[model samples]
Target: MSPDVTAFGPDFPFGYDKWLGHPAGLGTIPAEKHGAKVAVIGAGMAGIVAGYELMRMGLHPVFYEPGRIGGRLRSEPFTGQTDIVAELGGMRFPTSSRAFYHYVKKLGLETRPFPNPLTEAAGSTVIEIEGQKHYAERLEDLPPLYREVAEAYDAALEEGARFSDLKAAIAARDVARIKEIWDPLVDAWDERTFYDFVVSSEAFRKLSFHHREVFGQVGFGTGGWDSDFPNSMLEILRVNLTELDDNQRFIVGGADQVPKGLWAHAPAGPMHWSPGTSLKTLNAGAPRPGAARLFREGERIGVTDVWGHTELYDAAVVTCQSWLLTTAIDTEEALFSPKLWMALDRTRYMQSSKTFVMTDRAFWRNRDAEGREVMSMTLTDRLTRGTYLLDQGEGRPGVMCLTYSWMTDALKMLPLPVEKRVALALSALEKIYPDVDIRSHIIGDPITVSWEADPNFLGAFKGALPGHYRYNHRMYRHFMQGEMPRHERGVFLAGDDVSWTPGWVEGAVSTALNAVWGVMRHLGGRTERVNPGPGDMWDELGPVRLGE
Candidate 1:
């Protein structure tokens, strides 16, 4: 008899690492296939994690990175500073990213609470809108209208989707309850934008657009969720239902450490590698040249790098943004079916921009004449949509993320140089705290990133638009190509874009593990007698296929 998923109760299959160790975890490859090589393109979180784990299982996983190892998780230190650094991508992470955190904890990295607005770490927040400022130590201190918006959001969630019950079902791994709640939601909300959900809800409809505007400007959890308003409502619901935006924390030194650490970490008692082998030591301190072309060669796959050096591998995992397949590389016509190619071509990426400067110290923490700090975690309607302050230590130097923006807000700053971006942000902040001298405290040159402007990455991350659920479902389920023809079995897609929650690292890790399972199966692996892979239980717990 199949194991009863309901018996697991509250112990869901979401734990990627746990799933690996579970009786029903990934299947194992036979010893004869253990030493076969695997090619992993892109050195991002998904690539690093998947490669490391595969290496532990006795597979020789070679990586191809056009640039640095930490793809989008870039943390740049000041030129002359000892430890002060600016986060150019993925600054904060929520605790719910358990799969990603598994490696973080294993590597023994320290993390501190991120100062999201209304959180205690924030100390205070200034919400600026409509040329007015309101300072609050907590959410309750905000205007009654703001509170009403917050309450209305909760009521809408409860009324429209049985939020509490769905959450309970998810927590319990109650697959039946989950499908009953989620399948219907996917069918109803797949064609609806987040803006539509917010405006059409009975609770939000009762209030004027002013309340909606306030909610847009100063959203709960993370500030200014308006950038996501135009995307699918299912996207928003997935984020909230999974709590991807809550309980966030910053890696103490840098978020890039997650990927960097994985590259050098030696898992305890790894199979074929020596006791101290790492991805770095395994590759002789360098990655294979960047993959420039990919195609099928008989039963195996071939990848040719920029230098025209070609190598054949038993299986390949593509972890970069999917568009690069067509734009940056020479891909064969038959490698991916037309439908899959369409999904890759149609992937919509959201734009993002961030400007940062190293400060002499956490000077913003200094008390003013009125016995209040000069500034706090700030959210505003101005060009600098969100500002975050990072405290390095009590008296040591620190970093300030002057402006982190998305969507149209991100597009507006795309053309500006770093110095001008910093200047523009300072000008906006000056209006909120006319008393604070933001320019005088800067100790180093400013740093900035417009992800959309980066060549290797065309955009920050994927944001599913309304009617894009089918595309996402198709991309995410591509890892299950073992059931496809032999030619398609050797190539796997793994990345945040190929995940349900496109922007969250958890999704990246989850999808990468799925690809690992797919690779194992393709290479003639089998689960232990008692253990079964996710594919073994697809009907009970697989993602709902709407309109199928």
Candidate 2:
């Protein structure tokens, strides 16, 4: 009921006539030409949002998803009741993601206020010592030296309400309050991702006691620290490791269910999905039979495949792994060079392991003393690559828990056989939740995502490196073009990687919305689309640029 008119305000779906053009069951019907037929590659949020925009313009879109519809926007329904709806990809976001809010509301979907979980938990901070982890009520328990500096530094950082998140607690001397609001590092989408946040943040400079917890590198003091990782890599590690944000909301079932609902409601059009398929090449020069540019066709880009397999399209888009986009051919000058690709590789990524341990629910379901959902316990690990929980929708129990979401600077070096990657995940879990009855508890690990080992994605995402603020600005400017603030269209690129707000659902949504708006404006007759204010962080800093 609520989504019927998302951005339409108060109540929506006002008049379908105002929104739909052309004819009924006919956005897909070909008529004249508006110039070029758009081709969106990669099926993730960026690609999907682009496709959705094209269809809304009375033009058809041939959504090309080399894999399933959702990219990192996926779920593992295998363990069914046990798997706990593990979202191995983009997690949740806050009201800060304006486009997401508009999109959800415009679609007229049900909306619920997400109750913050950190409320009930007695612990909001954790520290790691010599690989061992422990939680704390106040950061005071840390070594006297760090406790002195960090506390002093933490004392100064303020969150003005106008600043997206206000830090009244810092002024009020409320440890619990600050825990709920402040992030040690800035959240910016830059080529430097998390790598840039660390060395640059004010908090890290003051607090060095829990360096591992703050920088999150596996074996930091070890040989893994190389002259190679001087700037971006080390900086990203520091920022992401120490940065934190907890504003939250989620759909009823698994997160993917929300997108599925969107698709089910989309006006009829050409939607293609081939999960096991891989894009061999992007035949740009050598012409194939039929549509020379099926990728930009009406609705059926009848473009031929590697072996002369042809297909049609009204507007075709490739929504496969982004690395594939860069690695489409065997030529040296294909998309990006191997060194460039290798440089891309050294960027950053997220790795996770989830074991949906189904327990006799209803037990942990009780609202705590303060009317909050009880969180059994949360143990922080210095080496938890990249991990967190996806609050399943109403009525669904069990934790969609996670582990080890990190910028894989060190991991890329390890030679992981498929079995080893799987084993590493289990081992990491064993360390986190030692109480689980290994054989009986885990129902055969229904799902595991070792992006490093997966040849397709190379790595899940690219973390923001040092000085990413500059790089991000350049990317967004170069790609989103319009008469507005920051609009770069022609080279439209969207992904968690491109969005300096790396390793989270927020960036993905951020990337998609901008791209969607750009596509719409290109076909929005003559009305220019506005660059949705850089939501939050508008005045704080511009997109990270490379050379200052």
Candidate 3:
């Protein structure tokens, strides 16, 4: 029997590894350029994937990370606890993010369906707003008012955006069709906020402000998307159409394992190094010091480490957050155009906070007097906002993400310590399940994170405001700098923030690959007959810039 290729999906989208293995994908560089060194900043998934692929193409990529290799793919396990964790950063990923799954499958990693509200894995859900509680196993179980609002949302998506058609076009890689559908929407919604899109729509107009408020508090997929209300409609569409908010799964151990695995993985072929040599071995098991400054000297780009040591590299891919260029690092003004710098400076990020706890077991699984789990994956208008439960199985320790909030909600918990945050979350949760003593089941100290408090990352991820597409277009296309004037050819940007879908790992991985393509060209290489990079399909697949 033929192998099941279903996980790869039906449209047979861009084959990342297949493209690499193809003859057309091979030998992009001149023989003399083999093993030439390139600088890769940030050891996140983007940097790691780019470095890994560059190594396969016979280039040596030295990575520099200020902290750990995972970047925002951080999974914090409780102290002395195994099989339980708090996902402090990017957690769930959709299957449609194929490029990301390619690495996951290659590393022999396991994944389980994320317990998103209303999904089968979610079991049940509780949506509480204004002191009224509604429990359901499905959307239909909600009050008629909510059902009307849900129907309106579905209708609006169909009539206003042609959502299903757009999703299909993207799935098929029918770039022309995608552009045909997406371009007009960008023109229509680029200057509008998600809230504007909803209120102005025929469906939402008929609904009451209270209905709108309920929808804002407990959205269908992963609690409220209201944090995204202030962002451009185009941003929301990119997320929804690409399935970033649906059919998701969590990496079995930890999401960070993906990048960590790639760092140590040894490719098989003429990599110009030993057969079993890996990035870990090549870097001598340590990353270069964090870069404190970057500037163009004579021909190559000069990078200064935090220790004030400076070195020059032929090319550099900066996967760090854009704000660092101005705030955390001293980058030469001449490296990027004034326009590009403006875009980087204008990039806005959303603040996010999460509080998680380790429990002895899946205590929530314990049946109540009514013969149901005491609690469900929760969504509420209260301070806690959203809560998710994770089961490690019958006997192993389980984890509960007590609260996940963004923007104003996140800022509220910023000043509090971890214990206080956990206490506040429990106090709020107790109101919903008054009979249950949530604090009693805890097995270890709670873990909490306020991304805005972290110096390395000023915020969680980019949350593009209305009229921000031009800025995004500039940043996303920074990899095309080889085509720019001589002064702007070396420094390239790649990260989730620079991608169209911020906070999604697929964006990070895809944009990183885009940077790899750019770096190859910068190093005097070109794609062969069939394995063309994103630039080759630029006209069809390029982002829809505002006022284009």
TM-score of each: 0.96, 0.60, 0.95
Model 1 C-alpha lDDT versus the unseen true structure: 0.83
Off by over 4 Å in 2: 1-31, 34-37, 81-84, 106-244, 267-307, 310-322, 329-357, 360-376, 382-397, 400-402, 407-445, 467-474, 480-491, 517-524, 528-548
lDDT of 3 by residue, 97-176 (tens): 77788889989999999999988888888888888988888989888988887787887788789977777766555656
Q: Each prediction's Cα lDDT score?
A: 0.83, 0.40, 0.83
Q: Candidate 3 — which residues are off by over 4 angstroms?
A: 1-27
The per-prediction CA RMSD against the true structure, in angstroms, equals 3.4, 10.6, 3.0
Tens digits of per-residue lDDT, candidate 1, 1-548, equal 11111112111234454576664445667899877899999999999988987887788899999989888889898869645678888888887677777788988999988999988888888899999888888889888988999999988888777878877776666667877787788888888988888888999999999999988888888888798898998888877776777778999888899899989898887766779988998788878878999999998889999999999999999999998998998988788888789899999999999999888888888888877778998999999999998889887887889999998999999998888898899999999999898888888788899998887899999999999988888888887785677666788999999988888887778878878878888888866666666555554566767664
**Is 2 or 3 the stronger prediction by TM-score?**
3
Arrange candidates by TM-score, highest first: which order? 1, 3, 2
